[model samples]
Target: MVKVVQPAYGRVFQDDEGAAELAKVLWKETVAALKEAEAVTLANLARADRYVRAKVEFENLYPTAYQQGPVLKGEEGGEYFNYRWSACEKLNERMLKLEKAMFGEATVKAGREKPAAGKVAADEFLGPDNGIRQ
Candidate 1:
């Protein structure tokens, strides 16, 4: 049998057919809902989109120093702060999931990976007697 290796696409691989089947089915219902009643999903998408837009807008508009209310004092004038997102954590959790589902699904981005464990470093010599400095 051929040996499988580490960092395959930087993610875990399904070792057997049953694991593969489970992975495929995990999102099957969500996809089916999108197909069967697309409008419902679209509405959720729309709400999520609006919230994201508002968030970005707030970031742009109210970029004042943290706890340094809008009217800045003399020393705090130069620095700016990001919008605080701690007030409604439950809403944040719900919207974050909805937003993640809308954005990061079925997409893959290339990334740099370190050399696998068995590979030798370029600086190392190949022999049992090769001394390693402490």
Candidate 2:
């Protein structure tokens, strides 16, 4: 996952390309969807592994997106900031609460040639791996 941390100047954008390539190793269906040059972005990649979008969204939204909803709006007005902040926090909460829905087990290996890279499968929680099983 560290390999996927691309600093977006001031903001942090999830590396969908890295994720997709990593997915091709850990995720069963990602390679098929990302087969061609689809401009590997989270939205496009989500077509294959939907949980990826959730995790990516949660990652990009926090600490700085504390950027808009609250980061910028905190000085605007508590009421307005609260609204945006709530929305932002709500998203974060969903990512946390819906960990199972957002992430689960790896179905199977997509194949070889694709190394595990620095990517962690969804099983390891924050590192990746879709869900926490019982």
Best by TM-score: 2
Worst 10 residues of 1 by lDDT: 1-10
lDDT of prediction 2: 0.44
Task: For candidate 1, write residues 69-134 as lDDT tens digits.
Answer: 533335646644333423333345655666566544556777888778766674366555345545
User: What are the per-residue Cα lDDT tens digits for candidate 2 across 1-134?
Assistant: 11122223122224456544443343333433344434345543443344444445555455466655453434546434445466567766664544333334337866657546665455466534344344
Clashes of each: 0, 12
Candidate 2: segments with Cα more than 4 A from true spot: 1-48, 67-79, 82-84, 101-134
The 10 consecutive residues of candidate 2 with the worst lDDT sum are 1-10
TM-score of 1: 0.27
Task: Tell me the alpha-carbon RMSD of every candidate.
Answer: 18.7, 19.4
lDDT, candidate 1, equals 0.43
- Residue 114 displacement (Å), model 2: 51
TM-score of every candidate relative to the true structure: 0.27, 0.30
Q: How close is candidate 2 to the true structure, as a TM-score?
A: 0.30
